[model samples]
Target chain A: MEHSGKPNKIRLSTNPTNEALSKLKIGDIVYLDGVVYTGREGVYMRAIEDGEPIPMDLPAESAANFHCSPAAVQNEDGSFNMGAVTATASFRFSKWIGAWFKMSGAKLILGKGGMSPEDYKKHFVPNGAIYLTTVGYGTGALLGRGVKQVRALHWRKELGLAQAIWVIEVENFGPFIVESDLEGNSLFERENAKIAENLSKAYEGTRPAVLKRFGETDDRKDELI
Target chain B: MISIDLIQQTAETLMDKAAIEIPDDYLDGLKKTASQEDGDLSSFVLQAMLENYQAAKEDRRAMCGDTGCPRWYVKMGNEAQIEGGAIALEAALRRATANATNGVPLRPNRVHPLWRTDHDNNVGIGAPEIEYGFEPGGDWVDLITVHKGGLFGTDYRMLFPSDGIEGIKRFYLDCLVAFGKRGLACQPAIIGIGLGGSKDTCMVLGKRAACLRVVGDKNPDPKIAALEDEFKELGNSIGMGAMGFVGKSMVIDCNIEVGYCHTGGMQMSVHAFCLSSRRAVARVFGDGRVEYRTDPDWFTDYQRRDTVEWNIPENQTKSA
Candidate 1:
């Protein structure tokens, strides 16, 4: 397939600097090596919007955060079993992504479905951060395979494992799309506009048949049988 | 007679299978659609999905972290005997649900609407929700368990009797457009349309449609089946392929099930199932024997097609 460029590799032990990320373009696939905390639902909101202290030291491990709340289970002793890592919609969790970028020293946000055009323009471009989307469904194995370790540190009781912050280590974690790039491009917006035009054209072609079969009024006879 | 323990064991098996494995029809259908899709980005996405499917299978892991709340449709023979009554059967299913939560380590997805509290085990009031149907004979319970994802939920719309056939068609097309633009519901999704029933009946039909085999069958009615074909073709025209990246194969399948409606109005519902489409089937016999079913053969009188109709125009191109 047409990659924006080669699949560039970034190790999390030494996280890729903005200069390294700037060279990447929208549509580029990436593989990351490092640690990302799983805290998308509410804890992230607390850290990003409420000025609350992060459950763990994110900047020290890597500023990268995967928008995932894993499917871990508790043992009889109340400890957690290793669960699957799956990404959720980033747009829903990104109200403070700009602030997240500034405050958390974030460089990359990976999840399913990219953000709005406004979010990309306002935060991602100016901050030199990039947004990526992984496969949404049928992807727990892909996610599960990437994870090397999982340590639950916060919110197990309140949010359950699905919405808690579980610090995880990974090696070459990826198959993600550069949905929004540092170059001020939002792939999601571009594709949205394109799909809208195609749908209109398609509707134009099918209106006649639809009208003929089911229409109450046949005003568009010119396009019909 | 099927014992309560057998029923619980059967439910557990079905849930585990549905969680860890991608059904054969859906997996094959996706590969076929991916090969037909002609775009680098979209195809890449599909390939990645296939990879994940394989990984989940070989690694014995779940396809998605959202193991989803359990929903089932059970078809039993009129002569079938259960050691315990209907409540006992339901209790067994609830036990199985709890087992699946620990065994699959399924995410605690069930939350009380008012309390917003995590049920932890995923079994709650009226939970592991079961719908029942009875057949004329056979002394067995035919069951299929479906897993519903978070984004594409069960949606219903009420159309007055005056909003006739054209209106129904328009409503479906409009919904497809909205689904395409929003990307809230992932594309290359399975669309289930229920027509003419009361609100609840229409919704149940829609859910049943989503749980049916992708390439398996259509309604027995010729006129209704034709409408289904048309809907499938038109739905693909929006081109929301593989996570709304804009390609030819927007939908894997469109299932339409119709019901008799009242004189006042028609109730319509549309259910979107992502590529995961996780479901598993089983049959529990009177001898307390249980057999797991791999293919989701939900419909009996289905009219099979040669190509599962998707009309992709030749030599047409634009933005993606």
Candidate 2:
């Protein structure tokens, strides 16, 4: 850590260099105080599977691609004013997630929902890429506040905002969770096991006992709630 | 008579605002859940969410970018009159959707189910779903829009009429445990349970309860309302906090909807809504007055009664 900071908010004082991210473990809460690119549903597939060149100028050799679909408005001057870009489900693009990581030398991939655990064990650890889950759905627009500028490129009109690749400049971005890390760790599996264990213990109790455990606060004991 | 222009204007307004405005009820629920969050990580997740809400509001931008597909539930009064006939509602919705797609924009989410031929507009066959409900006496139309994100799950089961509440609760818990424990489903979500209907009807009702009803709204049925109050502790007991970051408050609210079915069988199901809870309503009067509503008051439209007082602290550890 470059500076002592609040526990609730860990500041990554450096760019998310591979060497810097190497020390970061699963479950570590930190914000990326640096730049990341906004790729789309097919960005990885095009670059890796189709052997297409990536469309961005990448300020750095190593990068992070947040699966984003930012709504863009064309000003009279013709520069697009970007509004909102949020995470998407990773499962659809799981096939190329690792390839993008290895090819682009990405330290991180941010999106919504989960990716396959099989891929986590197979691709993420070896490639040194971590899958981070971000706040998605209704909050995408607010996330746009992190963007300083958005430059649209190749297939910008054909693919529109959702599928088009964009180079986004970000500063102090992210409150995303480290769901899967380069250490071959999956928080999804970990939390699943914990909940499964808790459920087992919960089921062992008698029905009335279980009800009493949670329903103790309710006044009407006769109710079937 | 309400003008076609008014309906078009209403749809256009809803198309933009539905994705932008975080409803009053949902914001209240977020505050309630945040206040009760147990762990530092989970609490911080919520705190950041609240900040994002503020930022989105001030910037007049979408809270989250997904803004998913848009769906509308329109409730019309029997006495309502419209210019250019009833078909104008659909026409208005389509034009408004196109306008929103181009301008006060939404993500072009509608794609062909099989081939993925995205229309680039958030409209397609069987989309912008409009369900019509009628009231006895009024000259107005009420339209509620749920800017739906990806749905995580829908579950249904046939239960004997004799199966009763235990069976219903068990089914709901099973579904939530199986599908909702992951951060994929998000946390501090709303749970909706549908009871006493045919298989498909129950599933539909389950979705309505999940996506349409107000967070923390009680079911009219006393028994269902009681269960709604308990689901928080019950869901938290499973231990999936906000975004599954780990904490106590998994489900912040639950709403149940029930319908009568043929005597042969009773069916039940469960549906879940993520924390974003994006829904809002707008109404058009025959005289051409238009007003937007943040409080949907869905439960008041149905009658369910309960008299249970449970005031568990939000931060309390779920324990034996």
Instruction: Compare the candidates by TM-score and give the number of the best one.
Output: 1
What tens-digit string does per-residue lDDT give for candidate 2 at A50-137?
7877755543632677776766655668677666667776767876776676667666777775576788778777876777777533
Error of 1 at A20 (Å): 1.7
- The iRMS of the candidates, in order, is 6.4, 7.8
**Per-residue alpha-carbon lDDT of candidate 2 for residues B155-208, written as tens digits (9 for 90 to 100):** 677776555565565666666665564555655677777877788878878888
The DockQ-derived docking category for candidate 1 is acceptable
DockQ of each: 0.33, 0.25
Model 1 chain B is weakest, by summed lDDT over 10 consecutive residues, at: B311-320
Q: Evaluated with lDDT, which candidate comes out highest?
A: 1
Angstrom error of the Cα, residue B319, model 2: value is 52
- Cα lDDT tens digits, model 1, A104-160, are 777778787777778878887787677877764447778788878765557766556
Off-target runs (Cα >4 Å) in candidate 1 are: A1-14, A48-51, A77-80, A205-225, B160-165, B295-320
**TM agreement with the true structure for every prediction:** 0.87, 0.85
